[model samples]
Target: MTEANGTTELPKTCKAGVVVNEGPDFTVAVEDVPVPTPGPNDLLIKLNATGICYSDIHYMLNDLPMGSMSSYGVRSPGHEGAGVVVALGSNVTTWKVGDRAGIKPVYDCCFACELCWSGRESYCDAAPQIGLNFPGSYQQYVLSPARYTQRIPDGVDDFVAGPIMCSGSTIYCSLKEAGLRAGSWAVFPGAGGGVGHMGVQIAKAMGMRVVGIDGGEEKRELCMKLGCEAFVDFTKVEDVAAEVVRICDGKGAHGVFVTASSAPAYASAPGMLRISGKIMCIGIPPIGTAFAGADPLLLIGKNLTFSGTKVGSLLDTARALEFAARGQLKPIYEVFPVAKLPEAVAKLRSGKVAGRLVVDFNA
Candidate 1:
């Protein structure tokens, strides 16, 4: 059992990636910082790894329409993290030392809201995101709320669990919202990307036939290895949507899960869905950019539904973790040590990475 601030024999400082510019030209600097103490409802976690989400890139660039990370008083930017509990706060009991755990995009949500009560806490209007509001998992240690923290299961490795906390879980919720059954054709616009790759695996595990659309041969190979039934190389295909429609038996896919930020992905999504099909969105396009094809006439004519999810509820994370454990949602990430986080960030920003990039803090 841990006692208040002295919870465990912990070091005063730990290595972390600090955002220097805090804006579009931001860069990360590896520095030593004081380890944060857990509050009454929090747990101090010693993170082993964190996933480099595209959202992290957005936070560092201040690209979101919302206020800057500086406005939120956050410097380090990250969300998907997996580690073990090191200490517990005065009121924390749901977790203990050595218990594997993970953090998600949402650090904490107003649990009293109707959304939270209905198990949709990820959409809480006042929720403070991990990398934005609180110090993110880019550090060696982070504070996680007892209620918001995820319990990483024994079978799921930390490397896989990290991304599962955010990207994996986000797509998992999208799959659920899609309500796709076995043998249904599901189209993933960016099937080789982080969220899309996980979505491919999850959709497959759910028995859905997947048609993955992306650019380049590398992405196509990754999608196929991850169990996508059909891989569509958008860069080579004359008409990606038309090809997807053909792959789905001439009408359209049962659903189109858009996990790519490209405007064309959203614009062409409506054409890839079957009658009564839904578009489950998890990607964030550039600020001020709207889904151009959201014409009510088209939606009404096709009986298509448009719904989206941000991160995901804790339950959603749990389900995704299970999928990873079952070898259904395997990660296709390039692992980098914490010291190389800046390089990982740069590579992701440059669009050179075919899948997710994970940072290992212990290194």
Candidate 2:
């Protein structure tokens, strides 16, 4: 691990990753590739930590938007990234070498577009995802557009801030869009999984009462530890949705944030929403999958608003990290070495992982 002439050379080809095919047969391999070079406005980050996200598994399973999947073809998978800036392109100014920066889901965005101007670059019509379209952080080092990488605060550990870049930020944005007030009740469908766990803690930190819905004793214990006001084990409950409604005093939740990709969980959303309530869709419902829940007329009658939210902007990402820095929110994580990605992904696919999974570069 030596640096010379601004080249971080370990071997001629350092460890890197790629997606090799289609469907479950599609595999993520950790062969080596030439180290990437920084372009103008790009900063080369020597990644210390990266998170395995559900979206990565979705892409490997061929579960992305059909148009984008076909148009972009397959690429290496990764996005929740945290690292130290090792080198910067000549044109980069906002950051300097040694700055702790995060390469988020958003790699390059049309910064001049209306969405970006409004601080929603994650939703930029011309946005290109990191691990999705471009080569992402599943490598020795990653090159990121300086404009899109947010700097992590000095007090925050990179491992803790890694999930905040993507999964944590997505839930944060969804909660913001839901517009729940202090003391309002919000139900998170998959409240014990990686994203749902973070959302439960964040919702509690915002002073909202959180109802967690997930199964098993481990998840139930974790949800309770994360400050959830109620935990409904879907496996044990007679009616999961009704349990959520009961928790909200029969008025239903002020809002229900669907963090689980299960169709049945999504189908239960309308029943859990109070009158004039909102439903925020944060999880990507299963690929090639569709839902026909709650009628259109019922939406009008309940005055409910259904919305889709992407990850937050760079500013929002900074705020999310701040929550972690101040100890107001915590990202529970299971650490694994970079070489063990498949095992980590398998745990996630099996729905057994309780919190986020982080790949350790220095392990």
Query: In TM-score terms, which candidate is top?
Result: 1
Q: Find the candidate with the highest lDDT and give its number.
A: 1
* Clash number for each model: 0, 0
Candidate 1's residue-wise lDDT over 124-213, tens digit each? Answer: 897888888889988888999898889998889999999999999899888988788899999999898999999999998999999999
| Model 1 weakest 10-residue run by lDDT | 1-10
Q: After aligning candidate 2 to the native by TM-score, how far in Å is the CA of 107 from where it should be?
A: 0.9
- Give the local distance difference test score of model 2: 0.82
**What TM-score would each prediction reach against the true structure?**
0.96, 0.94
Could you give candidate 2's per-residue lDDT for residues 187-303 as a string of tens digits? 998999889999999999999999999989999999999999999999999888788888898889998988888888888888888899988888886665757357988898889
Which runs in model 1 stand beyond 4 Å of their true positions? 1-8, 290-292
* Candidate 2 clashes between residue pairs 3 or more apart in a chain or in different chains: none
* RMSD for each of the candidates: 1.8, 2.3
Q: Roughly what TM-score does model 2 have, to 2 decimal places? A: 0.94
Poorly placed runs, candidate 2 (over 4 Å): 1-11, 66-74
